[model samples]
Target: MAEPLEIGSLQIRNVSKIFGTFKAVSDVSLNVQKGEFLTLLGPSGSGKTTLLMMLAGFLDVSEGDIALDGASIAGVPAEKRNFGMVFQGYALFPHMNVRDNIGYALSVRNRAVAEIEACVDEMLDLVQLQQFADRKPGQLSGGQQQRVALARALCFAPPVLLLDEPLGALDKKLRVEVQEQLKVIHRRIGTTFIYVTHDQEEALSMSDRIVIMRDGAIEQVGTPKELYERPKNKFTASFLGKSNFIHHNDKVYALRPEKIDLIVGVDHQDARMNGTVSSITYFGSMQRVIVDTKEGQKIEIDIDVWRNANEVKLGDAVDLLWADEAAVELQMG
Candidate 1:
């Protein structure tokens, strides 16, 4: 068995990246704990990729500092950082088989032949690719190719792994399967993983903490549950999940679809609103009902299909009820 890596914590102190006059990343400060799965999540042009590249030493920081385990690595080159990297393209050698590709890093370092072989074998088992050791890149599926790429990056037991949308090329079902596998690999290796992606579901499902970026700055950084349940601003709330924005008495609040209950032909006094069902969308597991209120606001409620005892249709009058605590107030950002 391969020994556990001495996982290092990372600290980004007011980091910024600028291209001439354009600020790609601006004054972003974040602290990542040892062995934590931290994901940088945002849409395109949100500076997530730029920040990741800076962390990987591919881009120079225009301002601020980056440190590993309390030591400044701002001057370190990408090759000297000893951080593993996995990209979306799965940059595997087309001519080499899985074993050779995974063992390339060790071979280049002039390690012993037996040591390289053992490390490659261990990586193959880590990624569950032991049976396809001799398969070329062309012979493997996209998911398998990605696994090989992961194994290659991790074979040398780097203290940190930087992944830039590594599973973006796979199909939806395959992507989900790989996410679970990646989580398992992280747990077993106990190495710090810094991931970047624009997929909300991927960040919510896999990350120990998510850093939501917007317009080249940090919007919010918190655990998935904390960000989902109590967002600090409108951008964080709407970006992380589906939310119904409610304006009441000069205050703005966000309520999740699942938190609202839909009732027909009955009215209650506690945080209730009456509306007509505008549309009903059937997703396999749940039904999304959009209600247009008399106050000219559209609210959405999610009802589990299996637990829905009452059948709701479009144009039906419905009442929406939710607890006061379920409505999270938003601040202007």
Candidate 2:
């Protein structure tokens, strides 16, 4: 069996990347804890990928420094950094079988033949690809091929693993399956994983903490629950999940769809709004009801499908109620 890897932490300080005239990434500083699964999440051109490339040493930092375990690696080359990388494209050798591809890193380092074989076996087991060890990339499915790519990058026991949307090529169902597997592998290996993806669900479900970037700067960095429940700004609230912004009494507040209750009459003392049902959308597990308020505001509420299937419909009058604490105030941007 292979020994456990020594997990490492990262410190990104005032990092910026400029291309002649345009600044791709601006003054971003972050600290990643040891063994934490940190994900950089945002839409295209948000600079998430650009920041990852700098951390991997593939791109130079226009200004600022990056440190691993308290040591500066700003001058280190990509190969000498000893960080494993997995990209969207599998990039596996077409002619090489699973075992050879996984063992290639060790073989090139001139490790003992027996040592290489043992490490390869461990990697195959780590990714649950033991049965397909002899299959070539062309013979395996897309998901299996991606797993092989993961094994190859991890075989040498790099302290940190950098992934660049590794599941982007897989189908929805297959992508979810691989995500669960990746989390299991990370737990067992205890390696610090810095994953990059634009999928909000992916970041919310798998990451220990998420860094939401916009334009070229950091918008917010917090755990999934923290960011979802209490967002600091309009961008963070709307980007992380669906939010209904309420403009009342010269103040702005954000409320989640699920937090609002729909009732036939406005009898309670809590915050309430009266509106006519505008539309209803069926999503299998829950129903989304859009209400057009008398004040000319459209609010969305999510109700359980089984409980509220026939309780309300389009053109029906309803009251939306919620506790005062459920409405989170946001700083005006």
**Per-model TM values vs. the true structure:** 0.97, 0.96
Off by over 4 Å in 1: none
lDDT of 2 by residue, 215-236 (tens): 8899999999999999999998
Assess candidate 2 and give its lDDT.
0.91
> What would the per-residue lDDT of candidate 1 be over residues 1-333, giving only the tens digit for each residue?
367766579999999999999999999999999999999999999999999898889999999999999898999999889889998798899999999999998898899999999999899888989999999999999999999999999988888899999999999999999999999999998999999999999999999999999999999999999999999888999999999988888888999999998887546565379989999998989989999998998998999989885588889888889988999999965
Find the candidate with the highest TM-score and give its number: 1
* TM-score, cand. 1: 0.97
Per-residue error for 220 in candidate 2, Å, reads: 0.4
Write out the backbone clash pairs for model 2.
none
Name the top lDDT candidate: 1
Tally clashes: model 1. Answer: 0
What is the lDDT, from 0 to 100, of the residue 319 in candidate 1? Answer: 80
